[model samples]
Target: MKNKNLSYKFYVIMSLSIAAIPVVFIVLSYAMFFTHLGITSLFNIDNHFSGSVLTTYFYIVFFGILFGLMFIAAKYFKKIIHRINTMEQTVRKIAEDDAFPEKLAVIEESEDELNKLAASINTMIDRLRAKEMELSQMEDLKREYLKQLSHDINTPLNALNLELYLYSQNHNVSKEEVDVLYQKVDYISKLVNSISSEALFDIDNYYIFKEDISVHKSLKQTINKWSYLLNKNNIEYTIDVQKNLIWQANELWLDRLFENIISNIFKHSATNQIVITVGDTLIIKDYGVGFEIDRDHETTGLSVIKNICQKLNIQLDIESTNAGTAYRLSQE
Candidate 1:
């Protein structure tokens, strides 16, 4: 395909060379006629040469000029063709190797059409790279949202499953418990619908649902929701919170923060006792195998916790040792 395109330009130059033949013939015939009439003063000399020699010199000069022009044109076109092929090869390498490259070489000193073409190609490559980065970031954000959604909904579903199990075992489940389960179902529905919208695509627009709620109540509810899992793992927990402690916060986010902390404890902390204390601050500490603070360590749950703390204007401090890990949260 590349050779075919170059051949077309060669054909065009050949056609131009052929078209120059008649113009050359006309000039030669005029010169020969003038010499035949002894009107050779236009040649800038007296008639000291024969007509045949003068005719030969005219033919040589005109045809030589024609060939010289053709040679110059072909050389110029060859440079252009080489430049275009270089650009084509660069693009082909990127497509075939799927690798990133810096911008194409653009000769800023020249104000010709080829320089403009190179500039245009560089601009196109930059825009495409920017768009690719944007898409990649969006994909990462989407995955995070999905993981958060999974964690948020999973706790409530587990609570619901526990309720069903208790009922099956002939245990008396209260009416208020059923109402709370209904509210969780409704909250999950709203979250799912919101995540489906374009608002979730941007980080700035992620959390808009906020309300004034009792912090004690939200924390207690989270513990109760995770009661089944905690018992299954033989992990005991205690909550010490003031009954009337209230704070303005996103209710779901508050619940998620507590739930994620508790979930992380069960998953990572190899201990049996978990304690929570809530007042001006909320603290959850576990007697378990803690990690080194200086080391870089992160998990999905911890990342979600940090993000929520930042969003809700909460100050989060974590202390870890071989004995235990303590997470302290306070409004800032």
Candidate 2:
């Protein structure tokens, strides 16, 4: 792979042609001298042929060599110009379309400066495409996350509003009711902080903040928080999570994971009895009309749940039928 620049090629051709000039001139001078002597001595001919005939021969030879050199230079330069033109057209096309192709055409046979430039452009296009894909995926994740976040925030907000309304009607708020309000307010505050700080969206920090958390405690607290809605709907539920069941997980994300699961149960599982067990595995079964898993169940809540489970290395399995729906989550 001998790469050559335009200057190097041009210099080589020009140097050879220029260096032949003195040699050609010296050879012509000797030929003219010997021809004049030989013709006059051997044939007794006149010396005027050197001026007329030999001079004409010299001019013809010199012009013929000049023409041959020019022809070679033209042919070589033509190929270089064509390559340059092709590169220019490619660049113009990309600029006009405002997009990069997957690859650039490179002349592998000739490792010239132009080929190297093309290879560089190809590398740059690959990097740009990768960056584009990353940004696009992030945008999609952000969009889905925001949808799920709004849904999660709405539950506590509605509870808080309902509690406030009840207090206004009675003109007296009980201690338990006040505690519930405080908890709802605290949860909403955390949601706001998480949103403002971009905690959930920050991939590097969110999944790394793990700790040992009691499964029973977290589930119990989530159920208590959503008690207002469950009671209003008259939905009966049972929990079998052991107090000793502790898992190493991201506490905030675990809370969110449970919250989304419960919220989905409340919204989609139109069942009266909900059973949750956390022993060797976690299972949330509802005795309601189940949904078809093969359908487009791309709800924000489910998306959030799946995202959390995937990032936390949790395996999720869903079973659904006309009899009921059950979601099982376990460590893998």
Candidate 3:
């Protein structure tokens, strides 16, 4: 950015140069005094002309001229110095008040250098004000869209969850399936709430992530929750786990990660046995009839897994074959 103040070096140099002029003159005056003494001795004069009116007049005129020069120098620098100070104040006002200088306070309408500078500054100020107004309108629109979109989508979701809850009361419905339905409802509810509470639409605010999660504890709970769900289907599973590992993460999100993965296994895999391990990485392997990952399908859990892992800065790797399917989630 261009500086708002004029360079002070120019004025400083000029002032110093102006002050030196009198020193040079004074040295010449002293030299003339010595020469006059030489002349008096050569002429054999008994008394010096130091008290003479002519000598007094010479001193008076020399000092008078020196003072006059100083006065003129001060007067000349004053207006430029004042303009620089005023420009600095104007910069501050433009920043804080977002207001341009008053018309009278501007250097002038005439085409002087200072006036030209004021014109440029005013132009910049106008552009800044316009850009700010544009950004303000954009933010307002974004917030309104988030507000309406959240309402429109969640409204139907709320009605659907209530219907599902009421339907789960029937004797024909399996309690395990009902539990899964409730989990779905809870997941959707949390997704909405997270977006709303996090000010995800408010991009201007700085974001601070809070993890404070004991990885071992949270992942163990997640596994146990899925174990219960899977055990109901008579599917056997074994776990190998490490102790006392902790990192930054949300427990619910951790649960969501494992929940989605396990839920996919149950829905698609006919496997009776699975093994899970937790250490430097989370590894889940199933000896299921592995299916090909169809890229056209959004219903697959891969996309959600990809997203959450990214948010948590965890690396996800997948391997599948005719014999088995394996998933690995680890930190980088």
Residue 30 miss distance in model 3 (angstroms): 23
Q: Return the top candidate by TM-score.
A: 3
Clashing pairs in 1: none
Order of candidate numbers by TM-score, starting with the best: 3, 2, 1
lDDT of 3: 0.71
Candidate 3, residue 36: CA error in Å? 21
What C-alpha lDDT values do all the predictions have? 0.75, 0.77, 0.71
Cα error of candidate 1 at position 219, Å = 0.3
Better of 1 and 2 by TM-score: 2
**RMSD list, candidates in order:** 11.5, 11.1, 8.6
lDDT digits (tens) for residues 125-147 of candidate 3: 77887898998898778678777
- What would the TM-score be for candidate 2 when compared with the true structure? 0.55
lDDT tens digits by residue: candidate 1, 234-316? 98999887546666788877877787888788888888999988877888999999877546257526777888788787889
Among these predictions, the greatest lDDT belongs to 2
Looking at model 1, report the run of 10 residues with the lowest lDDT sum.
Answer: 1-10
Report clash pairs, candidate 2: none
Report how far off residue 300 is in candidate 2 (Å): 7.0
Model 1: how far is 262 from its true place, Å?
A: 0.6
